[model samples]
Each structure stands twice: as structure tokens, then as C-alpha cells.
Target: MSPTMTEQIVLTAREARDVPHGEKGKFYERASERLGISTATLRRGIRSAAPSKERRRRSDSGRYALSREEALLISATILHAQTRDGKRIKTLKDAVRMLREKGAILAARIDKDTGEILGDLSDGAIARAMRGYHAHPDQILAPDPVTELRSNHPNHVWQVDASVCRLWYLEDGLQAIKRDAHYKNKPKNLERADRFKVTRYVVTDHYSGWVYARYVRGAESGENLCAVLIDAMQNRGDRDILRGVPEILMMDKGSANTAGMTKNLCQALDIRVFPHEKGNPRANGQVENGNNLVETTFESDLRFYTVRDLSHLNKLARMWRIRFNAERLHSRHGRTRSMAWLDIRQEELTNAPSAAACRNLATSTTVKRIVSSVLRVRLGGREYDVSQVPGVLVKGPLDVAYDAWGDEHIKVVRTGKDGRPVHYMAPLAKRGAGGFFEGAALIGEEYKRKKDTPAQTARAEIEEMITGERTKRGAEKARKEKRLPFGGTIDPFRGMSEKDARPYQVPTGRDHPAIAPTVESPRLTPTRLAMLLRDRLGRDWPEDGYQRIVARYPDGAPEESIPEVMAAVTGKKATPDLRVVKA
Candidate 1:
């Protein structure tokens, strides 16, 4: 008959407390198994509910007391067996044997009658217990090698990796903050703490040569790898530049890349994974080259103490990547990364959904504010009012962009300029009823200056003012240097053929050197000298300078060494009348 619940509880407590002291440690496991409960639950319930003091049992002895390590080992054995393979090691005798195989020591009873181990313990028991814990051949999961992945545009396959760097944290000015009651800066002398372990993960576009890099504590962890990828995707200037989530990510079999949890996350996001052969890890050559380039830039030029913190190193990595892609020229692409990207992606970019639709929902965005309202925004310790117009605002960050035109002004907050987002009021005087085109010029300027200044209205106004001044100066110069109206008659040089353009004959020492009358006083100017020489020796005039000018009269021969020398020698001040030549 099955024991009642109360009776089972009583028996479990009795085993834990009244079992001979020499056997008390072993009783919990045996009693828990027999009573159909966990050792932990049984121990807890008995310790709390059972009578603490008991009459000394005759079998009580010190030899069987369970040490802490032994208890932990037994508990670990039970837990390990509780997994899918748990049921196979069901009996206490089996559990003890498994524990011994896992480096535990124990004794067992045997039956003299059938030569079988009694209560499930016997010779080779440890080996038998290990058999149940052994993993099946089919249980191992292997990585699948993907041979190919095709992409039509940028961001298709962003490769990531890590490297070490030494960084120096500036402290001189950082010290002032500690003294200032209002200052809340972190404690200084940070660079003195040497030896930072830096890891850099870079994502390079297969097509555009554009790359993004981040300094992480280590790229070996799934968390940091995921972070760098997300950072690259989110910070890109053009989000829709990607055709879709990358079709495949080519990576080596690094711990971070092949982590089960990370792999699962990638699957959930529909990112296919392709790992390179174990020994041959160069499948992602682009990003590896990117790391080298980063090293060249930082290791060669920028000196640092050590890349101690991941986030700080990442910030520096971002700055370096921006410079590498936007400003630095690459020999392979024969242009800047930005230029190459624009060359291949311009058409696709034009066709992408409007920037308004592409703004990420996650980040605090720039918003446009009118001049009538002063926006209260602070960044990096400075304060500014946003221009009242259509600007970008990162929701609650108090950052604002002013766009008096259609394209928002907040877009210009990228690096290279004042990286912080700008906030300025639109000038009321300039507000006019010009359609989107009227605003388009400002919009274009803002787009061009996105990586320049963060202040929306200030940048716009400065561009407009500078442009107006240049235009006015140009118009005044044009008006002052007047040109004659077109003449009704066309008689001479129109449609002249090459045959009509005879060689400019000039006097040589071999031909007419004696009769070629030299001018009493040479005209210093090229035009005057050429004419005087041509008239004196009509068929023997030097043709060098005159011939070049005559070929393209208005455009004129370039005022180079030949003309300058002729003018210097001739004493005449007249400019070169590049139109005339003697043949």
C-alpha cells in the first residue's frame, strides 16, 4: 500500500534526523528518493518542521557526517541527472555510483545470494553511472559552412572583429572639475591607471569601402558583438541604404560569433550566419583590413594610455572610423569611403523612402522649432535655442534642429563639425512664402553641412549670408567689367578650317638673319613685341607665343614663361594681344 502523505513526511524526517549519526549524511538522498521528493525540499521541510532534538540512536556515529563539499557534490549529481538523462540514474544506489564517477568517494552494500549489488550498488558501479551521463553521438551541434551570399548594395554584409589599443585619459583640465562645486565630472588622473585591454569590432560594406569600427572590452562575448553591430546600423547616415537586413554575416568561429544564445538571437532576427574554416579565418578580409587601418591611424598617430573602458574606447573608435571613411582617401577605391559609397549608392539612395520615413523610432530625434519660441536645450554643457522651423529633435533629450525649409535641419548632427545636435530659432525677417524649392536651397545647405555645425538656424543663416555676399560681389564685378553687345556682322574667323590656319612663320638665324632689322627699342609686352617683329620680318616672325594665342584667341595662350620672358625683354608695357599671329 502507498504510504499516506503524513507518513511519508514522517519517514523522511526520521531518516534525516534519527538515522544513525554515522549514516545521517547518506540518509537524505536515500529517503528523498524513496519518498518521491527532492533532497533540497526534503531537507528544508524537515529542518523547519521536524523535531530538532531526538533520542540518541544506537547506530549514531561520527564517521558518516557529510562534509559541505560532499553535500554539494551529491546535490550537483542529482541536478545533472535531473536533465533529460536524469531518469536513467533513478535509484539512490545509481546516484551514488554516478557521484563517485564524477570524483566522489562512497561505499555500497551487496547481496550474497545472487552475487548482484544490493540496493543497486556493485563493482564497476561508477562506470555504469557515467554511461547514463555520456552524451549521445547525435546530440552534438556543428556549425554549417555557407559558401556564398550575394548582395546588391551596401550594408549587405557588415563584418566585425576586435583588437587591443592603449589610451591616455586627459586629466589636467579634468582636475578643475573636482574643485568646482558645480562641476560633476569624474575623478581625474585616470591615465595613470595603465594597461587597458581594448577590442575593436569593425563593419565594412562589401561594395562601398565604407567601414564602421567600435572599441569594445572584448568582442569574445555575445553581448559586446551584438552591441557593436547595432551601433553601426543605427549610426549610419542613410538607414535605408541597406537593401534589407544583411543576407549573411561572414565570420570566423570565435566564441562571440558562434555563441548559442547569440546564434539564436541572430536567427530570430533572420540574420544568416557563415563561419569560416577553423584554421583559415580570413574570409572576412574587408573588416580585417579595416582593423589594420584603424591600427595604422591610432597606433601610428593618436597616442593613448590604454583602452581601459569599452565605451570610451568605442567612442574613440567611432571618431577614427568617421575620419577614415568620410575624409581619408583609399587607394583601392581611389576615393574617400563616402565618395565611393555615393558613387555606387547614389541612384539607390535617391530611390529610397524619404528621410522623414527613415528616422529611427528608437533614438531621441531632432525636431524643428520656430524663432518665436526659445527651446531649452543643453549639450556637452552649452545651451542654445532651436530655430522655429521643421528641424529634428531627439524626443526628450532637449536637442532640437531648425529647418526653415522642407528637409529638416537636424540632419546635420553628424561628426566632423560640432558633433552635438544644434538648437536655434529661425530668423523671422527671412520667413517668406516660397514653396518647397525656396526652402530646398537651405535644405541642401543643411544636408551638405550635416557633419559641420550642429546649430540648425545658425548654420542655415550663416550659409545664406555668405552665399548672398559672394553673389553680390560677383554681380558688382561683372557689371563693372562690361562686355560689348553682339555685332550683326560676322566676316572673318567664323567656321575657319585648319587649312586656313597657316603656320606662324618667324625669322630664324638660318633664314634672313642679316636683313631682319632689329627694333631700335624692343616692345617689352608680348603682343607689341610680336607685332613689331612680324612687321620687320614679315615671313620670319617667331611663332612660339603668337601661334599659341592665335589658336584660341579669347581663351588666349596661358600666360606662362614664354610670354613673361618676351614681355620682360621688350620694354613695352602692352599686354599680349593673343588674337594676332603672322604667317
Candidate 2:
């Protein structure tokens, strides 16, 4: 048992005075330790006439102490103490390793941002210093060297991740919204309702802090995560604006990120994907901080009944995205994502071209084809209509080909009669695969499929035979065959089965008229005859309506200044009705 501190202090004071003058203070400390009185208390008690109020106060002050030489020995002890291998520091001695080092020690605090020392004190109470306090021989702590590595350009690097939403559903019999409102002294109906448990992937521009959130089924699979990421990048007009891919992709080493498919996809895209170190999630502090806010901000209201229905949950996540990017202020930027994104690149935005720069891009006109009034279209908008087929089912995969301006043309390729290439309008619904094809630029298979088919080969052969009819041989044969089949004793039809009942007739040579009959000819309008004359005379097409002019000369007409020809043709004026109308 420890003795009364007052008794111990008086004994130490008495011993100090009795000892030789050279050893007075040392002797007093030794005697105080033997008597269980603190050296500080002994010194103060001896300073006054009686060991009273002042003695008690001083004793309390010197509960933890060591002399100058003793401090150096303790510092050496701290420097060499064997710490428990994996255990974290909990006490002052454990923190500074005071049990192993014996040297003069001082208390210190280092800056969080810059590692420089904020304060230091050389004291004999080194082993008894507070937990956060540190002892160093130098005047201050060292500065961190990594602050100079910040990025300088916009879109230089973007951090992407999937995280849970921060919205919650509380199922208290008294509706959560109403309960909150009631507690706040407002009407129950005044509180806003919320949904919970939707998983979303958040992307943040490292430099600008611009964020985009997309609700996904889950981030458990590499395919789902990759699909969401690709969609977001394309939608933001990244390919149009940057014209290149990101240099680095930072992610954690989850199964989704480290899977073989993910590795192959990243390699194909030429992106360097890096994983954070194990046990140090703070390595991705920017994204981790965003996640912390997501989880912590709505912790009180979150309630997950079951993981079945994610529709309402997904809707709430989408709403939070608008709030997070458009309304919430970031500590680093001191502004919302919209404001910061513009402010960061204001120079480039101001200097870029206006209307004249956009002339190089192409545009398209859209047309519609109505069938059964149902109006089913596979395409996105009501545009692009100049070449639409009304009632034919198009075959093959739909392709979305874009010009420089992002104008889309839905096209399909088919073989022609000559076994050559032909292009046709592709069905709209089949064109883009709902924008999934755009990601193909960044992450699709590398090979293009060949378009030849067996049907095309058969058609090619038939067309070749039709074109190569021998002129000499076929003409002579046709002349010989023109003779009456019964007189010439030749069969009237060729390649007919003997059992057929129908008989064919061959034309009688020399009996056929030298010129074809004219009475049976389809009647040609005066306008048609005049058009033929104008074309034969090398005149441009007339702009006037021919139907109106034909009303005056319905039968025939003579060319102006061709009077002799008109008389030879039995006409009064050029028009057939000139006699009746003129009279």
C-alpha cells in the first residue's frame, strides 16, 4: 500500500537537508520515492514553513515527473522497447515507445495537412506525456511532399464508383414523413416523402468535382458496372468533346473490377486500371468521402424491408443525383457541380468557335410511313423521312451510321441482281440497340462480319446467262424458228412435255407486216407529241402546264414557222379545233 503523500513528502525533505550540499536535490528525490511522495510535492512542501494547502497543490502538479538525466535514460528506453507486433498504440508510453529509448524527450504535435510540427516542449515527464503528443530532437515536424502532385487540366482524370444511395424509408406505423413533420411543429402533410435502398454508380471529375449518378441494378457484376460507366461517358458527349479516352482508371480490387472480363476490356480500350491498397480505403479519399456522405447523411431514416422491389428505390436515387450535382455545394470547390464545371473551364468555353465552326457537320431530314395507323417505328425521333418504304418488312441487323455532326442514318446492306453491293433504309427500332452500339467504339468486339451469302451466288449465275446471249447464234436460230412450225415440220414450242394439252403457235415468216399496225397503238396526247418535238429540237422543258395548252389543240399541233408542214398535215391552224374556236 502507498503511504500518505504528506508523510512521504516530509521524510524526503528531511533527508535532503541532512545530506551533503552537493547531493541535496538528488537525495531528496530518492528519499521521496522510498516514502511514496512525489518529488514535486516534496520540493514545494519544503519551500513553505508548514506542509499545508500549498504542499497539497504542488504534490498534485508533480504526479508525473523525472529529473533531467533521468528523462534522457527514459527516452533511450522508449527508443528500444519491444512493442506488441500488431497491436495499435493505446497509452503514452506505447505511442512514443518510451520504454525502449533513454534520451531527453519533448512533447510535440504535427500538422495534419503539412506534417510540420506545431509545438514542442523538452520536459522530464517524457514517459508520462499524453497519447497524441510526440517527442522529437528537432524543432518542428517535417512537411509532406505529395501536395505538389495535383492535376492541372479539366477532364484529365475522372474517378468512378458504384455506391448505395443515401435516401431511406422509415416504416413507423405513424408515417415517417408525418412523424418528422409533427416533431418539427409543422403539419404532418408538409414533410417530403422518400424511398430507399437503390444502388447507384457515381462518377466525379477529380479536378472539377463535377458528379454524375446513375441507378444500376447492382454493382455485383462487371458487366453491369461496365455498362453503366460506358453509358454515362457517351451521354456526357465525351467522345465529341475530348476526342480521346481517359489515361487512367482508378478502382478498388473488388471481384467486379478484377475479373478477367474487366481486365480484357480495359486492355482493349488502352486504359490503365489501378486498384487501391488493401486495408487503406482512404487511398481513394475523394470517392470514399462522397460515399461517406451518402451513407451518413440519411442513416437515421434508412429502412430496408427486403431487397425485392427496386423501382421506387431507383426513382429516389435519380432524384438524389439531381440534388447532389446541381444543388449540393462541395467543400473543395465551394460551389455546385454545374457552377464549378463552368468556372473551371471558363477560358476554353469563351474562346471556342460559335456557329461558323459547326458548318462542317451534316444534317438529315426525317420522314414517316404510316401502316395500319399503328405507326410502329424502331427509331428514336420523328425525323428523317425522304426515303421510307411503306409496307415492306426489312431484313438483317439495323445499323446506326452517324455523320460528323452526330446525325444518325439508319441503313441496311443487301445484295443486288448483279451480285454487287446495295444499300437500303434500315428499320428504326433495330438501328442502335438502344445506344449500346455506341459503347462498341470503346468496348466492342474487334472484327467486322462478311456479307456474302449462298443465295447471292445463285442469283449471280442467272443474271450472267441473261447478259451473255450469243448475238450470231441466237439471231440465226430465231430467224429459222420464225417459219410456220407445221410447214417446216418443227415443233411449235420447245421444252414442253409430250403429255401437255396446250399447243404453241410460231409466227409465219414473210406474212408479218413490215411496219407494226398504227390503229391499235395507244393514243399519244398532243402534249406528248409536242414534248417529243421540243426534245428532238433540243429545247429545254417548258414551265407552263401542258394540260391547259392541250385543251386548245387536243388532237395534234404543228411547230411554229413550219407552215408548209401544217398544210401537208391537213390542219387550218396548228390546233385541231382551230376551225370551230376561231370562227
Candidate 3:
């Protein structure tokens, strides 16, 4: 029996290894001709091949076809041909041609027995295999590895995530209410706050792409997250058809999500918390996908609406949501998100938490703080004076329970193991008013502000003027009396003239010229001279002394010494070039 081409190459290389160094090249050349293989192939197999390769018979199959090992080598070579940093690397096509060099056999061959092609791997095939290996992990090791998630109904699982929005909103609305602390009057502070983008808390239905959202000023707190959740669950109208307490609140391990208070609140409401591992948000891909929708579609629509404040942003977002859930079609079902949600809602038994169940429940949020020497504790944005509590010894940090929604004032106290209220954590009185009964009113105002028409806004301004302002005369007095950003009045009159003291007012008529005393006349004597001063002193005088002007005037009756008194003590001036003397 005769050895096949691959067998002959193996045998030749084995024998060539024993040949003298000077005769190795000539032997390889002779072997290439006899075996119908390239000298380079013979040289490579000789250098890199193992000594124990199996032989093939002339009558056996795979006579002209490349082996699995050969195929892999060719694929690697093709992959190496890809460009590196714009430098010319070998091309895959050129690399493949090297396999078919002159006198070299191709990987595939037509069998003479059945006229069938065996092990037919093309250059294109090799290139594809190579690129796939380098580009993806496990493509070669374990191909098509995926675990598809199955959500049978809406709210079966809700994925929640927070992403900073891409664009800044106009700060004019947020700036309407000034913040004394945090970004106070800093240069570009408002711009920076807006440019940095507000955080958007998104809740997405896993079964449907239905989404709910809230945009806030800073990082999400535990209470804020719960509050946002409440909004998502509360069904405002038929348009808000996606409302329901999710069976599972899937989220990342953010401080807001992981806080004990947040867990307690959800547990009380019978909502399961499914937090992903610290770094993996893809676990809750529903919300992540929602983020993409926001970036592409919602944000694109925002170009038309003004983002002045949270209310405005939320209003626009709500309208966009309606369109997104009802009008826009989903790729998976060829139906809208709202349609999908309604379809699932038909069969699913939803257990949405009631308003009564959630009210005042956010008070579980607790923090520890040490009382300063001033007998006060600072919580949220307000300070409480414990000084009135009288004769309390110095103490370290105290556990304080506060309103998570900021809808109530904080009470300094310790909580039981179950997070129930215990005794007073610290002896202190509630210092100031917080988000209480009027919180709803404030929210309504914000909503109105956002949706206000030109007429409504003007009317609101007029009402504000009526309520926050005084009578014209009183307003004048109030404007002159300087106060603070918060309260209390003092004479801020130091740096201002009388006109400047009343900045909001514009002068008219005689008041247009300042009420300051002029050189022609100073203060009225308050005696009988008051009539004389009030009646005749305003006339403009000449550049010379007042005596020249007074002398040219007619004298009063002999009974009245007022004219002589005025001539003796006062000046009447009618001067264009005259200047007022300082009083």
C-alpha cells in the first residue's frame, strides 16, 4: 500500500529530522515534489509536528483534505491578519491563499470513488470562524449560551432603576423657590445642577414595556424611592392603566434600595424585594430597557416641551408615557404596551396597596446624630431646639425617626426590633413646620404652575401681589424697611438712597425728582414759617446769593413779618445750573 499525501509529509519530516543540517533543505524539496505538498508546509510540519502522527493509506479517505488541527491553524492565521492600530496586517484572503501555495494541497478535495467533496472548508468560512473566536467569549468554547426570562403577566416582576437624564432642564422654575443651603448662589450653580441632569426613577413592567417614572433634584433616598413607587402604583385615571403593586420590586443594591427602612416599608405592603448583585443591573433588564426607551424616544420628544421644573418634566413625561404605552407599537407583540398590559390584566389578580395602608408608613426612616452643645439637632433642612427641654445631660448620637416623604416633622426616638416606635430617642420639641397638611396644597400649586396658561399665570401673579404684598403706601414703607431672605426687618437703608430703598417702585410727577431738600430751601421751620416754606420755596433761583432773588420779590403785608423773615433767613432760587446741597 502507498502512503497518502499527509502521511507522506509526516514520514518525510520524520526522516528529515535525522538528515544532516546541510541536506535538510534539499530533502524537504525532494519530499514536496513527491508528496505534492509545499516545501514550507514540509518545513513547518517537521519543526512543529509531533513524532507520533498516524499514517494514512493510499486507498483510505481524507487523502487531500486538511485535518481539524490544520483548519484551526489556518483560522488563527486569518485572524492575525486583521489590522492593528491602522497598521497594515495580513489580510484573511491573502492568509487563506497561503494554504494553496504552489505545490501545496488545499484543505478540500473531490473523492475519486463517489465524486464527493470531503472536508470542504472555504476561505470565507475560515475568516468567519476566526473573527467569531476573537470577538466573543465562549463562542468557540460554548456557543449560544442564554437563559431567557419568562414574565407571564404585568407586575409579576417590576424592575426599578435610576439613571441621570442626558440633558439639563431650565432652572428658572426650580430657582423660583430659593434654597439657602446646598447650591446657594454659587456661580453657575443652577446651570450646573440642571446640566448634571436630574435622576429619573423608572419602574417597568417585565411582561409589558409599560413604564412609570419620577424626576428628582438629587440622589434618591429610601423614602423618595417609596414615594415614587406609590405614584407608579396609584391609578390616576383610565390613561394610567398600568398601575399595580408589583409582586417583585427588582432593583440594584443602591443605598436607597437596600436601606432597612425601605425593606420594612415594602415588607409591610407585602411587596417582595428582589435586589440584584451590587454591580449587575442587567439582572433587572426591564428597567434597563426602559432606560434605553427614555434615552431614544422620551428624550427625543422632550425637545418640544419645556422642562422648567419637576412638575413640568413629569407632565411631559406622563403625556409621553401615554403615547409610548398606547400609541407606539412593541416589536415583540406588534401591539402597544398598554394593550399588552390590559391583555395581562384580564387574567392577573393584582394586589395594589391602598392609600390607607401607605399613609404615614414612611416614618420608619431613622438616623443617628449627636446633639451639639447648643441644645439643637439638625434633621433634613431644618434645625430643632432641644434647649427648652431643660437640664439634660450631654449625650452622644440619638436615633431619630423622620418622615421618608418629608410629609411630617422628625421625632427623636429609638425604634424596637420590628422598627416600631419606642420611647423618646431624645428630649426635644418639633422646632419648625414641615411638609404637613399644606403639602398637598403646595403640590397642587406646583402642578398648576407647570400647567398654567398665560392668563392663569397673570392671575396668579395678581393674587400673589394681593396676598404677599401690602397697600401702596404700606408697600413703600415695607420696601424701605430692609428684611432678610427669611424674615425680620431692620434699616437696610444704609447703602441706599430714598429711591433705592424702594426698588420695586418707579417715581412719578414731582416725586420723579427726589424728595431731597435743595439749596433754595432746607427743612420747614414747623412754626408759622411752614406756610411760607411750603408756598414759595420751590421756585428755582439764580447762581448768586439768595438775597438777590429775595430782594427782587414783593414783600408781604406789614402785619406779617414772614416776608422779612424769609428775606432774612431763606433763599428763593430759579437757577438752571443749581445743584442740591446735602441735608
Winning model by TM-score: 3
Report the lDDT tens digits of candidate 2 across residue range 431-517.
266654221343464754323233444545543354332354653454466644224446666767777867679777676557875
Local lDDT at 299 for model 1: 50
| TM-score of each model, paired residue for residue | 0.29, 0.32, 0.38
lDDT of 2: 0.46
Q: How well is each residue in 1-583 modelled by candidate 1, as lDDT tens digits?
A: 1347556776667656556768866777887788787878777777666677766867734222233444444445555555464353444456666677776654444445875645534534433333333322112122336465445665556566665443332233111112343223523323232223345566777767677766654225776676655555443545223223454577788887876545534443335577777755457777778778876776555443443344555666666666667777877657877766655443433222222322222123344322222332443233343433244343323324333133322222322244422223432222346533233246445642222224545655554453433354553454465422122244566888998888987766465456766544222354654565456445544546465334334332233333443443343443455333436
Candidate-wise lDDT, in order: 0.49, 0.46, 0.60
What TM-score would you give candidate 3 relative to the actual structure?
0.38
Give residue 216's lDDT in candidate 1 (0 to 100).
54
Number of the top lDDT candidate: 3
lDDT of 3 at 374: 49
